[model samples]
Target: MSPFDPFVHVIDHPLVQHKLTLMRQKTASTTSFRTLLNELAMLMAYEVTRDMPTQEIQIDTPLETMTGRVIDGKKLALVSILRAGTGILDGFLSVVPGARVGHIGLYRDPTTLQAVEYYFKMPKEMEVRDVVVVDPMLATGHSAIAAITRIKATRPKSIKFVCLLTCPEGVKALREAHPDVHIFTAAIDRQLNSHGYILPGLGDAGDRIFGTQ
Candidate 1:
């Protein structure tokens, strides 16, 4: 829970916090950074999907009959916000391999600091599936905002935005733009720097995850 916005969820589990600290270190290698991101995503997935509905069914065990509760993974959709999002996407897939995946390609315009969409695609029957948009950073919120706005047009059953790091400005902007969409993140740092980057934050998640830097 964030004071800035009630819709924002800060996942500060010990494991999440620990890995995040490692990822934030400038000395961390590309290989280690990428690994931590995926592992963090997987850990966060448990809490993100905590509210999912489950149904119990009777099953025959080795020695006796028992009832087991299960969730329908097919009812969920993972929409990655392009290249960086794919890192988080991989972890989520490991948790729910049956989930349908989608992609929305967006890049920030360096000068104006706005999001520019280059590509967009989603699974069929999005209106009936719960969508979780994955991205590593929510700095300006431009990319997440634009991606969610477009996804809303499809009228999905529900939508939740997941990111690794974010700042006050980014969270505020996103909450204002889409109050209905709940935001989940590992940590919320101090603020954004002049170039629209989260300060005291992990640098360019996309770059680090893919070794682009």
Candidate 2:
């Protein structure tokens, strides 16, 4: 994937697009929003894990012996950025129940709009595992950049980012900051509003998920 184009994968599967349309509606209920987010996250996981390493092994079927392929890399580490990330985490875990999980608590600073890290914990031996960072929105890209920068410090074998929605500005910011990381999203919305919220986004994902606001 060239930095010129950025390795951003936009999921256009009909189900994904249809769910995203539901998510963007201002009238979507909190329960419905949460459900759609989880469904979309599970769909996105299929694409994210598309390139995972695999190895073939001989297996005995009920009728005959056969060779089959199974995922062959280190157990994946699903790193959730915070409260909203947990929503995606639920779906990702359903797809990879054996994978480990980590959490990084970073909230956007109201004044500077920069990421402020408060909590971080990850599985051991990061250098041997592939990590996928999960968050619902890549609004300003500051949180993704900051989270990956921290994860990169641990020298993981590779890293990828997944989100439900993003914008061109957010994509450009993340690509410029971390060219090595690939981004996967359901849709790239129009732009960020003045207050840094994604245009036509599903509103505050955490609040929608948890009914906080």
Compared with the true structure, all predictions reach lDDT values of 0.93, 0.91
lDDT of candidate 2 over 9-122, digit per residue (tens): 888899999999998888888899889988988999999999888889999999999999998434799999997999999999888888889899999998888999999999
Candidate 1: tens digits of C-alpha lDDT, residues 98-191? 8999999999999999999999999999988999999999998999999999999999999999999998899988888999999999988899
Q: For model 1, what is the C-alpha lDDT against the true structure?
A: 0.93
TM-score of 2: 0.95
